[model samples]
Target: MKSREKAVRMTLVAASCVWLFGVPFAAHAQSRVTLSGIIDAGILYANNSGGHADWSTTSGQLTASRWIMTGSEDLGGGSHAIFRLMSPFNVQNGHGTGRAFNVAYVGLADDRFGTVTVGRQWDTTIDTVSGFASNETWAGYIGAHVGDADNTNASFKVSNTVKYASPQFAGLSFGATYGFSNQAAAADGSSGFANNRMMSAGAAYARGPFAAGIGFLQADRPDAQPAGALGAPGAGVYDDYENTFSGSIASTAGVQRQRIWLAGASYQFFGALTLGGMYSKTQYRYLDATALTLDNYEANLTWQITPAWETGVAYIRTSGRYSGSGTGDAEPGWDQINLGTEYAISKRTTLYLIGVAQQGRHAVAQIYGVTPSSTRRQLVVTSGIQHQF
Candidate 1:
């Protein structure tokens, strides 16, 4: 009888072990995939020139429309591998923005070793600093600084890159990324005709209700147009023509170089209300050809009313100083104010309103010229509904 009891107990133990291992393996094989996206459309009214009159119907008017597919697989040992493919589209015309793989990357993550990813992805500056209170919460102008001065909207995403993020430890974490130029012969000094090549790095810290970060980016020979060539008529245009003329005089004239530095912080004061601000300065040097500097300041506040309603207001100012053989030390400036509000119906649907006004000074309008009218002051208002899945 004793021998028979011992045999039964050992058999039960073996059965339990098989069940435990098989259950996890079966679940891993059944891992799920999810498809999600957001569609935002609305009407806009602007007291501006030429584009669409004072009032017109606009789609994707307030927030961009996007679709994404993401999946993950358990790799055992408290680790997982994941991938995401994001595509942004223009809902108004049902046309693709050509960013089908806006964010296509794969990565491995573990509780102890953090996460590492390769392929196109957002840099540290955008992932950390740009999501704070002063940044855009629901794709509105009011949330970001003037013209997204600090790139709070992540206007540019690094390509051909590899990135790593440390697991959150004591409310503090950091991330870094490196984008390869992918040139066949970067060291040979012969392959320098790429349209875009950039490098960026940043660090961040968050403790309780306070967070702060700083970062820098450098690009070689990036495109620099006259200040007048952007936005409205009175906007700034690239100094390209002048640079060309100057280059003729000196064969070794320097090309355009762009560098940006940014720092920002946010703190929660009461309830769901938070105050945040950021400052960024950019310098454009024309390689011993000419020089220009742009200074930007932004401040904003975010208030969460109820669980589904939020409001944001922001002010931004930018000034540009031009020096070198071309401008004779003339300076131009522009300022803008933005306001935005959003209401959520569910985790995947939202309604938003945004308004912006800007002013230009000096030949600044001529400097920052726009395709529309080059007026000194411009105002725009947009209201839209967005659905996310």
Candidate 2:
């Protein structure tokens, strides 16, 4: 029965693509599949984790290391069948927590129209806005904005999604996504239709030395589908990352809804230096009429000091306010700085060092993917190697 439903859903998605593109279907001929992966490993030192100084080996400092397989088949008329499968894992012990395929999707692409994909996938925000956010993009996961409240780091992906990506025209492109509820009950015993659905949209433009992007997402009952949070222990998996949104307030009944909106832009100078900035807002709405709102303001500068050496620095200010709870209202905030330098030994291997410092107000200091500090201040430093294939 479940297989039948999935087949029906996939068929509808293909049909929608055909209608959207208004192209006659042709027999698929050529097929190609590519397998690629990245491995990142490092050693880390932190001033505090649950109040204790710690040393440990870490994985995926720059990005969650993952194995990926992408395939495409020519279907004629400038349209094709495409699919992707990816699994992010820790390199240290070779363990990952969550769906076996963190990313699993299949779709149809048309050169004249757009592409449509279905299955578990990313929302538009992570796809569009993350490029300008250094902390969440290239500076390492620890640079993520206060628990990745804005999801620029893609701490979580939406399930049961149908996504569209428009082709670029004059350096401009836009896309949207819809995630089915795929469940029947909300935390407050409500209809699945009343919660658990999701929608997102994004747009980007890159011309000359300038680039910009904007995106937004709304998820009613984010946890209606069972998925482990990335970087945390789940089932038999060990702790690989602790990167949850800090602005969320969870009760026994759970968070009711989530909404995020973000915008970012960047400009390059002399083809050597680049400056970028971004702003984001995330809201965790609860069934008890309570809500936590997080606002992030960030900026970064990166310099290509040499053909093989790259360096950057970034700062983030994140503030949050919680209201409507029985315990009354509270405000929390964090100010963080990140610095990084990397040397590319060759095209596929690199050596890097990263440092982070954070100060908290009305909250415990916690860096993304690390244990929370007992106090309001914390520091983390890591040096690592990354290899890509």
Candidate 3:
């Protein structure tokens, strides 16, 4: 099956090349393939890791450590054949994550029409609106809002996906994605789409110093683990979703559907400061009407203080609604602040220190990748160095 898919993609590229003939050159046709990635490591100090203050070595505290290989061929007539394979890993354990690749896709790009890709890929929510979150722009792991309840992190990529991105029109652009279920009716029966499936759409506008984006995502039976697969069911998306709910929320393996709405805007001031704000609402629905919902609001700012030094601050507030019985009936929320500084030693290497503080209401303070605090307050600090190639 995999070979067949690859053959089909290659055929598409061949057909495009034949149709285009000659025009402008592709971005990297002359170069062919490019290899690049980022590696970062640091010491992480958390006032509470699983109810205890601790210190440990970690990786990807600042940016996801990844390896990427991309190739492009000029199809002529302003068309290009492109393919990319990327994988993010844990620098600490030297282990890669999220399927074989964080992204593995083949596509055709044209200056006039747009781009279309097939394979594993991110949803529109992450592509369009995640940039406004501090988790991506400034603070890293500690900056994720209430454990990334909005599902904006790249940690969850949809498998079996087809995506289309339109060319910009007057600084406006839009895109869409669809992920196949790859399941049989005899196995996953209910709604026609009552299996591993997804549909997502997003739009963005950028002009001058201002930019804005909005995105929507929906998935059904997202916890699917097909037959003959390893580990427990719902390995990828479902595990991430459960972890995002933190300690107080009830963990359930029967998530029937998931939906998300995200919006964000940012502006640059004096070419030195950037200010941004974002909002997201995520719902994990099960049964008929029961759903676990989280709403996140965030404001973040970054300032370039000098040629070699930069600083940032982020504040996030999250509110949740739970409908289950027992402790789940009581709603929970949290407020968090992240502060960070980075000093560049060279163009590709930098040192960073970031601190995070979180106060949870009716729950234990929990940083995204860390364990929940025994108390309602938690503090974390990480100092690291990053190198890029």
Cα lDDT for residue 252, candidate 3: 45
lDDT of 1 by residue, 158-229 (tens): 666788888888877777777655544434556643423556677788888898888776655443221111
TM-score, cand. 1 vs. native = 0.77
For each candidate, give its TM-score against the true structure. Answer: 0.77, 0.86, 0.86
Clashes of each: 29, 1, 2
Candidate 3, run of 10 with poorest lDDT? 1-10
Q: Identify the runs in model 1 with alpha carbons over 4 angstroms from their true place.
A: 1-30, 50-54, 59-62, 133-135, 138-149, 186-195, 223-255, 363-373
Q: Which stretches of candidate 3 lie above 4 Å from their native place? A: 1-31, 188-193, 227-242, 246-253, 287-289
- lDDT of candidates 1 onward, in order: 0.60, 0.77, 0.75
Candidate 1 structure lDDT = 0.60
Q: Return the clash pairs for model 3, or none.
A: 22-77, 23-77
Specify the poorest-scoring 10-residue window by lDDT in model 1.
1-10
* Candidate 1, RMSD to the unseen true structure: 12.4
lDDT of 3 at 34: 56
lDDT value, candidate 2, whole model: 0.77
